[model samples]
Target chain A: MMPLWVGPVARYMATGLVTTLALAVVSIAVSVVLGTLLGALLVLPSRAVRLAVRCYVEIWRGLPIIVTLFFIFFVLPVIGLRFDTFVAAAIGLCLWGSANVAEVVRGAVQSVPRGQADAAAALGFPWRQRMRYVVFPQAVRRAVPPLVGLVVNLTQQTSLATVIGVLDLLQASQRSIERLTLSSGATHAVPILGAVLVVYFVICLPLTSLSRRLERSLQRA
Target chain B: MTAVDFEPGFVFSHLGPLGQGLARTLAISAVGTAGALAVGGLLGAASALRIPVVRQVIGAYVEVFRNTPLLVQIFFLYFALPEAGVKLSAFTVGWLSLVLWGGAYNAENFRAGFEAVDPKYVEACRALGFSELASFRRVVLPLGTRTALPSVTNTLISVFKNSSFMIAIGYPELTDTAVDIVSVTFRAFEVFIAIGVVYLGLVWIFSLGAGLIERRFAIPGGH
Candidate 1:
């Protein structure tokens, strides 16, 4: 039979994966909506609004995600807005993800041919109509591959939530190893750690390859 | 919500250790970036040359590092290695992990740079009878490095930011110093903000330096 720790450890890791997935899903959703809006705002006619958005992106992008996590986890509590550790992690990831996604979104939108915009203008299309009919479709097509890549990054980053006590897969493995060591004599740490590594490797490796393939095919088109 | 009281003097008072911490952060970043560039340069060159085993090895390295969380990599180094009879200090493990991780990303960036070199240029070099190594050194490396500059700068900044993760493994870096101060004074806001300012300063300075290098090496009409 397999080692006794296998079943429980698998269950524990599964739970951790759930948390990781939930965190990524919620954060990605929030980031996509907010990022797309902020990206649109980056090209706004109003100088002050564009300036404010630029600073926001620069600050978040410049700071480490861990520091952002720490700030939200620790500082928000001081101001009477306490969040669960997972919630804090999600919010932190959201901030960093949105900043980066905003940049990607802006780049994608800007890369759409200016001629298209000029043609739309010459045809008397308003800004909203032009964005809806002429611009967003192409930008979204251009954005999908990079956006998927960003999600993969966010998935990897959810592991950082372990530092803030989120009991992620890494933390689960750490806890299992400690527990096994205490309960049974002379437990090896490698197998357990290797299992956790394999789990991450399995999830992430394919996504990255897929992203590269998409990028290549997009270039071809 | 009542506004948290504005506090400036706390961080100012602890500037000495924090300054030391900032220095350590910079040291790690500089050393890590250098190591990454060295490893990545070799791997990228090998890849561009289509070396048999090296390409596969680099592919594995890039995928593994890119896919996994840096925190787990750090932990495996810090925790697992000791069990395997390789005792490494938290600082050494932290530094090594950053170098390894940065190298993988750097390799991809460099490979992209290498691929960006036009085929016609290589053909022209061949027509001049320059040896492969000679032509690569004379033409490819400079062009690749220039093409790779922006991405490499971004990677360097990320490696520096990632040095903060070392705080989890007990490195006496800037974020750790800030955590220490916050614990003692219960002033999380001021402490983190102070450290953030230093981080911002470091990033800005490095960006300025990168911009200078970019200008110095910029080829006319080169992207």
Candidate 2:
């Protein structure tokens, strides 16, 4: 049988769930747009630009997400640029997600057959036109599977926002557990945490399976 | 901001402690990678063997670990495990969690590698009088390991990065050391940036090492 506070805890987690969803959506949107641009730039003619973008990607990817979260939430204030906890968490996730998305974009774009681009150029299409008409159509199809995988990853990563003091799902659960224990005089971490874990499993399991299925289908294609 | 505002000297001042932290990070990552590889190898083999129950279990593990945030897993072990009368040191818990998490991903990588081994080559091994286990150990493992190198490298880099999550449990790894220095010096920007650079350097070195291993294992014109 569930505890009396289960109802209250569910209510509490609902709010946290909302926060998590919002964080994931905002971060995913920002990263997708910026990362796509960065990915496009990665294949540009200028070696210097490509090198610089590569460095950016490596730096963001190399640092731990937690470190990046701390850098944004804690370090930025020193430079006189401060953001709220949610904003800081979003920026950190965006930076990390964008770097990964950029790599996916670069890989997908490059994977497009070279002949298509050459033919487009022969037809007097400019670089942008070639990407728009000839390259992206094929590249985007290839990009979808990995991008879906990355977005799923970003969704899961929204949990890290708790570290930055965001009242996301995990943080809300912790707070609820503290309150419930204090009021009801029972230690019930396992059940509550188990429930929380299951919630994550529900939210993410489908997406992960979808990602794998997509990857398999992409391979077949 | 002025040029002097971003001082490189801050990093130099904290080099001793940071170096110690970096060493710990390296130790954790190395041990974690070794543990992951061991577990991943077994799980990968199990999955590839297609024993229904074993495959289902490994599939569950891969999905769970791949789906959830590493932070939650760390928290569950660090906070929840004590309630069940298993009081592990923060370092031990962190190390084990890394192995558990990284192993799941590595298992998938290894499974893919194992499955990618050409059937013809495996048949040739059997025809050459190698037993099933012997064929797998001699033929499947080497080829699978080679095939899995790139994914394994990616997983290792992630394991190294995830090691920073040990800070949540108060373990004094590189990120934690950076946090400590910043609290002492109020120079969060400089200290954290320096730590980021350290991580970047470590990842670069790790990738280079993996590249060398991949080359060494390269199958004569068949990369």
Candidate 3:
């Protein structure tokens, strides 16, 4: 008997896996960059900018990822901002991911002792110089492990794209199961879903372990 | 596709069905939170006690659940388990997945809480002639629960938010109801905005309750 996943089914699932990875990479990249900027802005002296960024973070973080995905995928088009399924999913994921990343960034930056900034000021360093040379270097070190943890989270969250009709790994698996069941008159959901779970476990476990390890090492340092 | 029209009142017209959906979401979230706390509390206590085989099993369980997406787990229980001669309704799958996922994270939270219990307290119990189990019950449980409260609240709120995923399996929760309304009314913007506000309001309530409980049980001058 030919193996079920060895032929076209395998190829199809591989394509889906690539899409999942692409979505994750795009979301992570955009969120991390955008979130860092937002996080920096959150702590600025300007009350208006801080309030605006805080509201954005709180509102986005407060909602579920699926709701956000639906809003971007379905609601946005109605407002004359149409995107392809992939782009819509990516945008939704990025918005949520960045909100969370911003919190992590804000927390890390805030955790730096006030004395450090005060001392920098005493040295005649400007706000930009103090942040660049003193505060941010320390904040980046504190942020690395959580940021890594967020990568794992955002990667797993890419699964949400399947709900928005993206042909991600989970979606691919579901389609494969449907086709296989129809063709063979037997359900393959057991093995197929099992494979999807295992695939996610494999991809995420190392990152989870790495994040934990980084956290432990950082705590000691 | 037409003009930018905002109808904030659209959702109120469908409040009857939406209210029922909110009830279902709350029901599942409440039950899931309780069930997860029970499971996590037991596993956490067991691991803390260092039962060799059980600790290893719990470790593996936590890693597996925590590392994978909850959506995939829902699909697994919903689709794959039926092939194994076990069947569950969509609602069962919904809350069960939450229990499993939240339980795993809560296990870690509770374990950390238990570990954070001051060793000095355990010593005090022993000095008073308390047995290991007695000391654990009399001293560890209460203090550890206090420490665990914040993270537990976080997990519970997650359970509440995650109930939204049940929409995929057709459980007719809040998100599902909104989606249904949008499909029929073609009022995607209004429906989603209203739903988003409802969710934000619920989450706010959750955190507010958590704060109250935390303050109520806080040890005097304790961090």
> Pick by DockQ: which candidate is best?
3
Clashing pairs in 1: none
- Across B73-168, the per-residue lDDT of candidate 3 in tens digits comes to 999999999999989999899889999999999999899888889999999999999998999988888999899989888888989999999987
- lDDT leaderboard ranking: 3, 2, 1
**How accurate locally is residue B184 in candidate 2, as Cα lDDT from 0 to 100?**
82
Candidate 3 has an lDDT of 0.91
Query: Model 3 in CAPRI terms: which quality?
Result: medium
For the candidates in turn, chain A alone yields TM-scores of 0.94, 0.93, 0.96
Number of backbone collisions per candidate: 0, 0, 0
DockQ of 3: 0.79
lDDT to native, each model? 0.87, 0.87, 0.91
lDDT by residue for model 2 over A3-63, one digit each (tens)?
5778888898899999999999999999999999999999999999999999989888778
lDDT of 1 by residue, B1-223 (tens): 7878968887789999998888888888888888888888888888888889879988889888888888888888887777788888977887799899999999999989988898788889989998888888889888988999888888888899999999888899888888888878889988988888878877888889989988988888864
Candidate 2 structure quality by residue, lDDT tens digits, B1-223: 6443778787998899999999988888889989998989899988986888989989988888887888888878877777788888988987899999999999999999999999888899899998978888898888888888889888988899889988877889899888888878888788888888888888889889989988888877784
Chain B, candidate 1: TM?
0.95
TM-score of 1: 0.96
